[model samples]
Target: MSAVTEGRPRSPWAAPPRPAWEGEPSKAGLAGKGLVLGIACLAVLFPLWIVIVTSLSSKKTITEAGGLVLIPKGITFIAYQELLSGGQVTRATIISILVTLVGTLFSMTVSVLCAYGLSRTSSLGHRWFLMTLLATMFFGAGLIPTYLLVQTLGLTDTYLALILPSAVSVFNILVLRGFFMGISPELIDSARIDGAGDWRILWKIVLPLSRAVVAVITLFYAVGYWSAWFNASIYLSDQDMMPLQNVMIQLVQKQEAPMGMGQAIKTGQLSELAVQMAVMVLALLPVAFLSPFVQKHFKKGMLTGAVKG
Candidate 1:
C-alpha cells in the first residue's frame, strides 16, 4: 500500500486500492507533456508573429532585414492602411465579412433545425432521413455536376451560390444530433408530462444544455465561410465579388495593387512582400478572434452528452 493508506486498517477481503496507472503522473511525464505543449504553441505562434511584424515594418526596415523583418527598428501601418483604405483588397475584405456572417447564420439555423428534428427518434421518417444524411457524408455529387445543378437553380453569379450549396453540413448535423440525444430522457419526459411541447422543450431545455456544442459548431461554420475562396472564385464571375482569400492570392501571386495604391508590383516604397504579409494578417485576424469563443465552449462541450449531470 502507498504511505497514505499504510497507516489505515482495511478488511482483509476488501478490494485492492485503485491501480498505479490511475495514480498521479510522474515528474518526467509532466515535463514531457509540458515540452510537447510548448512546442505546439511555438509552432502556431511563430509564423503569426513573423507575419504581423513584417506587415507593421516600414519599407526601410524590411529592406534592412532583407527578408521577413524579424527585428524591427521601426514600425508603420502603411501596409495595413493601403490594404484597408480602398481598392480591390478593401472590397474583397467587405465581401468576405458579409459572406462569413451570412453564411454562418444560415448554416447554423439549418443545421440546428435539421439536427434537432433528426435527433427525435419518434419523428416521422427520421430513420430514413438519418440514413439519407449519412449517405451524403459518404458520397457527394462530382464538382461538375454540382456546378451544373447550381447553374440550373439560377444561383450563378450571386452570393447565394456561395452559401446554399454548403449551407448544411451533414457531419455537423450528426454531431449536434448526437449531443441532443444525450439529453436526459427522464427530464424530457417530465417536461412533456407537464404539458411542455417538443418545440418548447427544445428551446427551453435542450438548447440551454447544448450551448457548448452549439458554440463550437458556430465557430467551425464561421471559420469555414471566412476562409473559403474556392466557391467565391467559381461562382462569382465579377472580380469585385471575390472574397478576401481569393483577392489576397491575386495580389500576392500577381503582385498587383493590394496595398491600396494602384502602383505596380515593384513600387520603390511599399514592397510586394509587405503587401502580401499585410493581406495574410488581415485574413488570419478574423479566425483568430473567433477562436477564443470556441475555447470557452469547447473546454466544457467535449463532454456535453457523455454523462448526465
Candidate 2:
C-alpha cells in the first residue's frame, strides 16, 4: 500500500481503536456477549410469542400441541371476539380505559403544574413544599392509615378511590422539575419582560419545548393506571366497577370466565388457556402500540431529568 493511503485518517463513522490498556476482544468474548444478548431477547419474546400463538390457535391446534401453541397453524380472531362480546369483560374493559385516560390526565396536569411552580426559584414556599415532597419519598403513611383516610372521605367503592389517592406522583413531579429548571433562565426572563404571565409562559413556551419529557411521563402514568389491579381489589366492591386487570385476575384465579364464558367457549370451542392468553394480549397491546411512537424520546428525556438535577 502507498504511504499516503496508510496515513489517511479513519472514517468518521468508524469506531475508534481501543486503547492499549483495553486489548482487542477474542472471538470467544464476542461470542459470549452475543449469546447473552440472544438469550435475553428470547427470554422476553418467547413467552409473548407463545401467548399470541395459543390465543390464535384452534381447539384442534391446542389439543394437538397438548398445551400452549409453539407454532401457529392458522390465524383466528375468535378468542378476541369472544372476550369482547362478553358483557362483564366488556364492562371491565371500558372501566379500565376510562380509569387510564382520566388518571393519566389528572396526574399529568398536577405534576406539570407542581413542577413548574417549584421550578421558579422565586415562588413562595417553594423550598418548604419541595422538602415536604422529599419527605414523602423517604416515608409513606402505610396501608391502614391511607385506607382509613380514603374511607373517611367516602371515596370507597368509588372511582375516586383509585384516582384521588395516587393522583399526585412526587417522583414524576421532581423529574419534571429537573427538566423545567434546565430551561434557559434568560428565555423565561424574556417572556416575563414581554408581559407574559406564568400560566401563559408555561403553556406557550415551556410545554412546547418539553414534549419529550411530557410524553415519557404520560406513558408512565397511563401504563401504571391500566395495569393496576391490587388497588381496585382493595377499594372497589361492586363487580360492575371492576377494571380489565381485575377481570383478568378473576379469570385466572377462578379458572372460569365470569363474563359470558360459556357462550365464549361455545362460539369458538376454545380452551380455558386460550381465553387467558387472549386477555393477556389485550392488556399488553396498548403499551406495545404506544411505545414505538415515544421510544425515541425515552433515553433523552430520562437522562436530561437525571443529569440536570
* Model 1, position 107: C-alpha lDDT score: 96
- Residue 160 of candidate 1: its Cα lDDT? 96
Per-residue alpha-carbon lDDT of candidate 2 for residues 243-270, written as tens digits (9 for 90 to 100): 9999889888887675677765766677
Over 4 Å off in model 2, which ranges?
1-32, 263-268
- Kindly give the number of clashing pairs for every candidate: 0, 0
Residue pairs with colliding backbones in model 1 are: none
TM-score for each candidate, following the candidate numbering: 0.89, 0.89
Q: Ten consecutive residues with minimal summed lDDT in candidate 1?
A: 300-309
Candidates' lDDT values, in order?
A: 0.84, 0.89
Cα RMSD for predicted model 2: 5.0
Tens-place lDDT per residue, model 1, 11-102, is 78998898888889999999999999999999998988898899898878887889797776778888777777778888888988998899
